[model samples]
Target: MKKTLICGALLVFVQQMNLVQAQDWKPVEGKIMTEWTEKVTPENAHQEYPRPQMTRDNWVNLNGLWDYAIQAKGAAAPSNFEGEILVPFAVESALSGVGKTVGKDQELWYNTEFASPKKSIKDHVILHFGASDWETEVFVNGVSVGIHRGGYDPFEFDITSALKSGKSQVLQVRVWDPSDDGPQPRGKQVNNPSGIWYTPVTGIWQTVWMETVPSSYIAGIRNASDLESKQILVTPQVTAAQAGQQVKVSAWKDGNMLAEQTIDPNGTAKLTIANAEFWEPGNPVLYDLKVELISGKKVLDEVGSYAAIREIKMAPDAEGIQRMMLNGKFLFQYGPLDQGWWPDGLYTAPSEEALVFDIQKTQDMGFNMIRKHVKVEPARWYYACDKMGMLVWQDMPSGDMGNGWEMKVGVLGSQTDRARTPESEAIYRTEWKEIMDDFYSFPSIVVWVPFNEAWGQFKTKEITEWTENHDPSRLVNSASGGNFEMEGTKITGDIIDLHNYPDAKMPDPGIFGKENIIVLGEFGGLGLPVDGHVWQQKDNWGYQSFKNEEELLNRYAGLMKRLEELISDGLSAAVYTQTTDVEVETNGLMTYDRKVIKMKAAQLKPLHDKLYQVSVK
Candidate 1:
């Protein structure tokens, strides 16, 4: 009896151990990151300066750990919270410490506290969220400050009214994410993970913090570049103390102001950068801008910003095919489809090192561009892209219903998109506009992809024209791969786009004698899951799984070599299938945990470099 009882106890202990082990992050069978992720704490997660483009030396980072609780959709904030979960990592992510999931029927509560900035009264405290997934409500000191609906864009609320002077300020965030169940433009996240359906991200999945700016500040300013004219048009949206606000602009390089000028309210400020230091995949130079918001000579606020002077266009190749060119010179763009997810932080990186590492790795491999595929990262990520000399192709996340007939055809739907109801279009347009206005300042983004493979794509011709007219300097790809229709005019876009996979091949642009600029938008997903990095056991998968590392490398090399041949056949830019494995999708050069580099540089860099060197002439 004693022996039997001892065996039962051992069995129970083994089962308990298995339960705990299951909670630990492991690399998927076909993905890479068995080792890149590290344990995070309330004190030391994502401590980097979150906002890179607009930097003020005196801002506080509210990242690290926060209390979290899952409750019913309409339930009030929980009186008591569940244990601590890492901030900026979504509840659904393993890095979040909770590894919990919430849907439309549920809401997530986040609670935290911090001391106010010095003399925060004179310095108005602005509570900022790098981003919140789906719908969000914010409370300061238990008073509701504001609520936002978009999942990907950043939002801020003036929380000074809700704070107690000099005492530690408390913040509470409530979130509801529908994932694929609603029409909020969530990319890849699905309740039931499957092929291309990634794990869901709920609640605050980005940097959360507070900034103390004066009551009257440069609320926001937009600077757009004209590659053709070597100038950047500046539009400052200032919140001056009184009427008749004016802004003073000064240009600088390496810390010295080159020029200064003043512009009245609602007027355009043109800073003509002579022989502009252009931004391209090879060389990205940003000019420092200091703009002072003034009312009757009283300097209400001064904000520092920067913009690059560069242009991306398509011109006819020697073979009569059009090729992508930057600054009127033949330039080849090669990139990975940067998914922008981390094992410990999900939507947010564990630390600034993690953020810089991805860019560094991409640069080390010698690729000059990254396609921010179907997701908008925190401003810091794009700043890294700019600082690290990586060009960007930003895609608006794909959304809208999949019930359309064109869905079966697998691209953007057509004019008669009998599928698009009135309600679906409303949410899609509102969020798309916010996304455009939020990150418009970054100089690295040369192309704005309004749609991807036709997801919720409607009014393509109209939207493309508006996008081009709104920011005429950058190139635009109207439809990437599906519902492929151009705006019946030569002036609509600068490049012709096509999608390729497993084997690298482009579509045939028929003999219209039109200048066809070809680009292989996506290709190559050779997955090899390392032993220690994976999200889950049953769900993770890749487009093409390989038996071993050597096989994966050989296949990748073979695919890239074919990409080079396509470049000679008019391919100007090529985007690989992924940056890293996420959730159930194991097709990444690096594993999800980011510990392993699946393909060696000696084997892959030569091929990528060859793509950049392929002559369009």
Candidate 2:
């Protein structure tokens, strides 16, 4: 009888261990956190579908606790984990529950177990990662699946063959990020962060998930909208082509079919919507898309998608000066320079709601545009802008700061091109192409700012021309606030941009007005620090500091009052200092914790509307 009791006790212990592993986890307390941090638990952390552009109803989110270990480079995966670190948050971030830094000589390892999705031999299981910093390799059930190199773009691996014959399967990943030590596009991340630079993000900093698909399925789709043509150019990519297979694309509005077309996988079909309403800033209209892979009337696979019809261009106005036109109308674009960094999550936002808050508040302030500075945000951020009718100017994150910088006030000056190694150039080219392709479908992104203030600027004429050829639909600002490379008084790209601090200013239209659209790329870094919301107690900095909200607003109003004169001269768009305070930079309109809005939305909206009214006749 005693032996029987002992056996039962052992069985109970095993059950309790399983229960402990499955319990929901909470975010570790950080030095400074957002309000959303309180709501972040394992069960509800980043629960929303990561990919809003091309989505499938059937998928699993792997964004909770995972066994993590830090080891020397080239070391084998550890058999025992050091501790539990939250997925989708970098190890150095506070929300990860593991505030540790993995240097260039170390590798960050992650291990997790998930159930195999019900599938047949003809079906495949695809493991998807929203993003992982630097170099990453994945393994399923101890079998090496694939490896991805870029840190900013999404990638996936088909692990159908590596699945084990059980309910649970083992998955492992290894990541290495050299940050600024390497020539890769590390953005503002550095080993030791201060000033404009911040902490390094080494490992997975985005959603991890999996989905099941047929052997022959829809691989991807691209949306190109032409407002003048009243049509959407959709091209679908198929995984495995079959005999008599065709790609069918349908556009729906409020459940009513507006247009449909079936074309070959390699062909682009124009889905025409009769009398299509243009997608504008206030009325952001979106059409639902349904794509199907069909084989002789049999639907092999299907996916849900969305699209926005809008056009961005530049043309000569009545005064013969180049002006930015949205659907052939002059609209002055203005907003904060969005750095896209979070104090709690570092590279990642604490949650989707938190991600939307910044965009929504920008719109509420009556600004029509946002300049997404250096760092790239998750796809959902652009999707939010699309829904809210906020225009975006996306910047390619800068790296390789070893180049020489030559600033020109207004004239075309000598360019100091960085002679990057072949490997470094290849890395930049590959990542830039991927970023453009991944974000091409988002109609909100009207401008692509390839370089910011000459940070790692190189191959000026060649890069600008290449970008124009790659995406002719949108105007390219080759280098915003970059070193001006002039060819007989003519600039290379579409716009001539300038950067001035603490107040409003613009590039001299007399030199650049006839050829390129002139813009104020950055200005008005008015700062106000609130107690208990700062990243640090001392050493906070900004271009101009204020003692209270009234003083800050009065200073901002003065800058706006000066900006009207520049607009009359020929400024097309302008970007303010930033959206929120970051690290030691207290120039943000809001505090780092996002707890206080120094300038009220109601007060700023009218002031912003007056700037838009000063357009050239």
Give the Å shift of residue 80 in candidate 1.
2.1
lDDT of 2 by residue, 1-617 (tens): 99999989998996787567646455556478999887776666687888888898879999988999999999998899998888899999888888899988999999999987988889999999999998999999889899899889999999998998987999999999888898999889999988878889989999999999998998788998878788988888899888789989999999999999999877787889987988879989989899998888898899988887888888877777899999888888998999988888988999999999999889999889999998889899999999999999999989987766555544333468888888988999999999999998999999998887777888888888888898898888988876766787578889988887877877677767878998888988888878899888888888889999999999999988888887888889999998999988888888887989989899999999998899587
lDDT for model 2: 0.87
Worst 10 residues of 2 by lDDT: 405-414
Predicted structure 1: lDDT = 0.74
Clashes of 1: 19
Candidate 1 lDDT tens digits, 486-567: 4452423555566656777665534311555667787777677766676766656877898789888888888878877877
- Which 10 residues in a row give candidate 1 its minimum summed lDDT? 25-34
lDDT for every model? Answer: 0.74, 0.87
In angstroms, the error of model 2 at 609 is 0.9
